[model samples]
Target: MITEFAPAKVNLSLRVGALGEDGYHPVDSIVVFADWGDALTVTPSDALSLEVSGPMSQAIPGGEDNLVLRAVRLLAQASGQDAKGNISLVKEIPAGAGLGGGSADAAAALRAFNRLWELDWPLDMLAGLGSQIGSDIAACVWSQPLRMTGRGERIRLIDDWPDFPALLVNPGVSVATGPVFAKFDEAPQTGAAFRPQGDLIGALQVATNDLTAPACAIAPVIDDVLAALAATKDPQLVRMSGSGATCFAIYPDEAARDAAAGAIRQVQPGWHVFPIVFRGVSAITPT
Candidate 1:
């Protein structure tokens, strides 16, 4: 059996480029994995099957259409290997909270299958397969700080990014990415090009998630989360991650993040909130 960690992804900075003729919006974003996420285990089997369990497991689909199942099948087809396997997904990241939970799971499956089958495919090949599943999948497969563009498939490595402490809060609401993109009146046509300046943290401070406005339009509650995070006692930059629902506040240190998480948890007990460090990989242990 092979086990892999599917770490949640946070869009540190997402800039939407113009709507393309293909009806997909191009994007330029900096993505990072989170400490909180899902776990996937793969065991050889005569048939392909998936069982999802964990705190957020109930929210995921168990059918063959699930991204994890699809990902394995796609990889098998691409590599001409048997796709039969038993995949167990232990979910933690909230669904549709702009955390890229499903995409991460699919990427994890690709990585595990590559090793299990000895396909020895390069990471780019895995990323190409992942692109068929979801735009975010390729970025998740890389599982590092990257500049993503071209409908989230184009990836360029970024070096010298300093770890930033963050507090992520999800209102437990699913905001569909489609609707958020639809809400954009004037989207970019050309891809955004920019160089990282100063320290990684400093560059992020100047960057922005272009989708935040449209996402807020689709889900008003996202504004509340952002506002709350912005209102924390310590000075922090609050922005909506990904398409919607989950928002994160960047803090200077871990202590500040912990204090912010505690304060927010106390005030919003019903919300799914956690303090995490933003790095290339998640700090949370995979189930």
Candidate 2:
């Protein structure tokens, strides 16, 4: 059996542009992976089947629409090979929380199958196929810190990224991405092109997630989540990770992050709060 780890994809800074003539929103962002996420395993089988079991498994669909199945099938078709595997997935990331959980799962499946089948396909090839299905898959396939642009397909690795101690929080609600984009379309921001600043923190402070306002409008609890994170002691940066509901705060160290997590959990017992040391891109090795 071959196993793969699907790390949570976090967008530290997402700068979205207006919908273009191509019917896609252009985006510029800094993305990183969290230490904790889903796990997937694949073994040879006469038929392709998937079994999902985890804390968040009930939130995921285990049918043809599942990204894991789609990714394996796509890889098989593209390689002119049979899609046959007994796949098991343990989902930890919540769906529709803007963490790119689905994409990360797909990427993990692609990588696992690549090894299981002895295809030896490189990351770029797999990422190219990933982009055909979802915008975030390419970054997830790379599984490192990068600057994503041009609808999230284009990526440039960040070599000098700093290790970030982070606290991720979710308000026990799922916010769909389509509606948030639709809301932004009603009144999009008009501004000059986005550019990175001197340092990571400075760049993140200057930039912002363009979908935050609309997401908050759709899910008011996101506002409360952000407020709670900000109220924590000594957070270097606090913002919504992707679209809504799930927010994150960067702290000076792991102690601060852990303290913030405890404080938030105390106030909102039902919410999902996780503290992690987000390592530099070079240090993020696949497990």
Question: Best by TM-score, which number?
Answer: 2
Clashing pairs in 1: 17-188, 18-187, 18-188, 18-189, 35-284
Q: Write the per-residue lDDT of candidate 2 for residues 180-205, one digit (tens) a residue.
A: 99999999975555677697798678
Q: What is the C-alpha RMSD of each candidate to the true structure, in Å?
A: 2.7, 1.5
The local lDDT score (0 to 100) that residue 86 gets in candidate 2 is 95
User: What do the candidate models score in CA lDDT, each in turn?
Assistant: 0.83, 0.89
Error of 2 at 91 (Å): 0.7
TM-score of 2: 0.97
In candidate 2, list every pair of residues with a backbone clash: none
Model 1 scores a TM of 0.93
lDDT of 1 by residue, 31-95 (tens): 88776678999998898888888999878876777898899989999888888888888999998
